[model samples]
Target chain A: NAGVTQTPKFRILKIGQSMTLQCTQDMNHNYMYWYRQDPGMGLKLIYYSVGAGITDKGEVPNGYNVSRSTTEDFPLRLELAAPSQTSVYFCASSYGVGGKAFFGQGTRLTVV
Target chain B: AQTVTQSQPEMSVQEAETVTLSCTYDTSESDYYLFWYKQPPSRQMILVIRQEAYKQQNATENRFSVNFQKAAKSFSLKISDSQLGDAAMYFCAPAFFNAGGTSYGKLTFGQGTILTVHP
Candidate 1:
């Protein structure tokens, strides 16, 4: 169904390097979210977008940024990667408030 | 601010038996939603069940069910007839609506409980 697609399923970034994580959903959902999962830990919110042109920071948005220029695409940007940033990134989307969220397979990132 | 807590970090159950994962949350809002998400080794986060605070009846999906205690602020997931496929990490997540009800997707997740089914 191509519910939520995240590119670069696995990535290795050198310290201080920058990269963008791409996420797209074909469900035409209004709410999109970015989250990171550390090893043996729960998911933490990174960034979220309510709609096109509307974005907000989540619990752990320090080293990340996101933009939602279109309804289907929400990309997270890392300006200067650090070893702590190494984790699995997930993208999710929902129809609206009180709706079920569908998550992507996730992007496993490692910083050296 | 709202918080969710899953006390059991790891649990094991024999196949064909049942297991219950505990979760507790603290929230002042009267209206909210609770969800149980299962993340298998495949790393796919799947929604197991959901419960609304306003609803008095518990929510059930096939072999998965939830015991939602609004007053106590507890939401737990019970897996009946545990199978090897049921082994996974279960996360208890709660979503609260802002005053305007504009945020339908913001979620606070508990640490999660790892379920192991012994065949």
Candidate 2:
């Protein structure tokens, strides 16, 4: 039941140097998301959480910063990294709002 | 503010033939949900079918099917035997249940449809 578990997976930051793209989920989901896939562009909503310490700001949240403190983590922070902050970062979970959304096997950031 | 339109950026079928991938949406929010995601190049975002705006009954998952035409809001995806692992890159997501703020489980996606299964 490793539903959604994203980690380094791949990275290459340099522009401003800063990284943190790790998501976790064991299905206790309370709806957590952070997406950004930009090469044919299809997934872009970069911050969300609806439980433990709630956080929000999606639709490509600026430079990105998120934290859900508990309930199977949801971390996506790229403090200063630019170059349009690279791309391909996804982490999702759902068990509410009409559940069914679980993805994560991506985190291919490359900000050179 | 809801928008999801996948006017087929790409599509190809042959292997067993039967491929229909097209989605359209625009909602002012009336309790919604519709999805079809499959990004395979190992990008892994697979959740091939789901739809329920008020449930007019149109959602399947064996040979994969969905043709919900909620008053022409249209949600289409039908892949019947065409499997070369069913190619990849096909997404049309829209999950809007914003009763006010904290918009519940927000998801809005489009600009995807690249399925090519030709053996």
Candidate 3:
């Protein structure tokens, strides 16, 4: 089972371009999250969803949007990619509070 | 807000030796959870070990173990018989359960510690 999967392993975008990072899990977890990892920095939560039709902003949610229409997927959207948005993005899911989290391989994005 | 701290930014240990990575957290809630995640060059975050706040006994997984001191808010990872594959970035993360103002399953992570295993 692919616990969690993220698409577009690597991508480069222009300043005003827009894109979406797709994440899906097969574990049927109700809690899903999107995080960004900068060099030498730990992962920073961007957005999270407790279940379908529910989403909340995390520590760093500027310049990003997310949706949870289903339990298996949580996609992150970048409206206007900026240099500051360039970082490695990771998607994770968990069974519930205090449960173990499963992370995807990660997607590396760069904006010039 | 909860926060995790990893004082050691980088460390090196010889192969087959024992090494410890330190971690500390700040939380007002009495019951929570702590975890250690390892990220290799492959960039996949792998769960190494976990500790529950109410469990006095430390958590252990084969060669990996955690020393959880709830009162002091310290949770450290100990690696025995370290191998080359252990060379990677280690993150200390903590989460609260059913905290009134917090989102469920959200984690607070430290800056991370880079471990180098010398052969």
Candidate 4:
């Protein structure tokens, strides 16, 4: 089974451009999250959703947005991308908050 | 707010040898969870092991084991018989409750410790 899937394994965007990082999970989990990892750094939370239609901002939510329309999908949107937004983005899902999370392979985004 | 710390930015170990990565955290919550996730060159975050604050017994998975010191709020990972595949960036994460009753499931991650296995 495909535990977690992230589309566009790699992408490049010019400054002020916008794009969406798609993430879907087959585990039927209730919790989903978006995180970005800079080189040699740990993952930083960008957004999270406890369940469908319930989303919240995270530590690094300045240039990102997220929506959870269904239990299977949680997509992250990067608007007006900046150089600081260039990093590897990851999507994760968990049965619930504080539960073990299954992470996606990651999408490497570069903003020029 | 909770914070996780990994003081070691990099660590090296001879193949077949054992290495320990240290982690410390700060949190007021009495019940929570700690985890070690490994991100290899593939850039996939994989769960190495996990420990629940309320559980006295440490968690172990295959060649990986954790030393959980609740009082000190420290969680260290020990890898036995280190293999080339074990070389990766290790992150210590602590999960805690937010102001809202809903669980954050959000993780406070450390700066990350890079493990290098030398043959």
Candidate 5:
């Protein structure tokens, strides 16, 4: 299986611009998550989905939204990109809660 | 809310030497899970090891092992025969299971510890 896959490995956005970070998994996992990591910092949960059609905000959900239409895809949307949004984003999938999660390579976003 | 903390901001170990990274967490739940994830320069998060709070037996993966002290809420990673490839940022995370049977599966991560391995 390809496991977790994320598109647009790197992106640069100007202030107020918007874009979506796509994430897909072939493992057919029901749990998916979106996390952001600042330089030399730990990962911060942004949004998560327990299953298709169920989405919830995590620790740092402001300025971001997510949708889980299919078990395979859970994309993160940036409504109005700000400089503070610049960070490395990672998409991960797992079979269930507390299960070992498989992570994507990560998408580096730079908002100027 | 549960929180994970890695006291050390950075650590270094010589080739074939041993290194330990300290991680402590605070939670009210009686049962939970803890994990250590390693992120190299490539930006891919790899699971280094995991431990269940209820398990008294420490978890070990080849050269990597964990000292799980449930009473102290400490979960430290011990790396033996440290290799150059072990240089990376290590994250300590703690997760709790939701009561609804839907795994919240959200990990609360610490600030992170950057491990450097010198040859």
Candidate 6:
């Protein structure tokens, strides 16, 4: 089952370059989230969308943006990448607040 | 804002032994939920167990169980009969809801604890 699919499993970007991390879930869930995991660190919330056209900034939303235009899609945007932005990104969807979440494999990104 | 803390960066246990991972959280809201997520080498976030603050009984799933102390604000996970597959990074998270019950699943996560199971 294609529960959650993420594009570009691995990516390398030069400083100041921009890129988009695509995330889509086939479960038709209403809540979607973006999180980043630094080396040896726990995942931190970047952005979350409760429903289509509704989005909110998470704990570490700086340098990142997200849009939930439909139930199946929630893409994260990095306008000007920096070395600090290098980390593993995960997209997740849940049926309700704090409920079990289905996550994508992850996107490993490195900024040079 | 809520906060969660997992002081231990690493832990280990024998294949057949038991291990408990500690987690503490602080929140003002009375209604909330707690979760333990496991991330193995595949980078897949799997749900280990969940506990609601209002529920007095601890949450248990197969060999996974949680020790939830409401007053102490502690939520620790205990894995019985540990196996090699249980070796992974575990995260403790807490989600709070307001009077209207709209939290968006916003979570405060603790620094993960890496579990090592020695065969």
Model 1 chain A lowest lDDT segment of ten: A92-101
Task: Report the C-alpha lDDT of model 4 over A1-112, residue by residue, as the tens digit.
Answer: 9999999899999999999999999999998999999988999999988899999988889988888889999999889999999899999988865689899999999999
DockQ of candidate 6 is 0.77
RMSD of 2: 13.8
Worst-scoring 10-residue span by lDDT in model 6 chain B: B99-108
How does the DockQ of candidate 1 come out? 0.74
lDDT of each: 0.91, 0.87, 0.92, 0.90, 0.91, 0.92
User: Which segments of candidate 4 are over 4 A away from where they belong?
Assistant: B98-103
Show where candidate 2 strays beyond 4 Å.
A1-34, A37-44, A47-56, A59-78, A82-86, A89-109, B1-14, B17-30, B38-52, B59-64, B67-78, B81-86, B89-94, B108-118
Docking class of 6: medium
Stretches of model 6 off by over 4 angstroms after superposition:
none
TM-scores for every predicted model: 0.97, 0.36, 0.97, 0.96, 0.97, 0.97
Position A111, candidate 4: lDDT: 93
Q: Interface RMSD for every prediction, one decimal?
A: 1.2, 8.8, 0.9, 1.0, 1.0, 1.2
Winner by DockQ between candidate 6 and candidate 2 = 6
On TM-score, the stronger of 4 and 6 is 6
lDDT of model 3 at position B58: 98
lDDT of 6 by residue, A1-112 (tens): 7998999899999999999999999998998999999999988999999999999998899999999899999999998999999999999898877677888999999999
- Kindly list the per-residue Cα lDDT of model 3 for residues A1-112, writing each as its tens digit: 8899999899999999999999999999999999999988999999999999999999999999999999989999999999999999999999888889999999999999
Stretches of candidate 5 off by over 4 Å are B98-103
> Candidate 3 - CAPRI tier?
high
A1-112 in candidate 1: lDDT tens per residue? Answer: 8899999899999999999999999999999999999999899999989899999888899999899999999999998999999999999998877689999999999999
Q: Listing candidates in order, what is each one's chain A TM-score?
A: 0.98, 0.33, 0.99, 0.97, 0.98, 0.98
**Where does candidate 1 stray beyond 4 Å?**
B102-104
lDDT of 6 at A75: 98
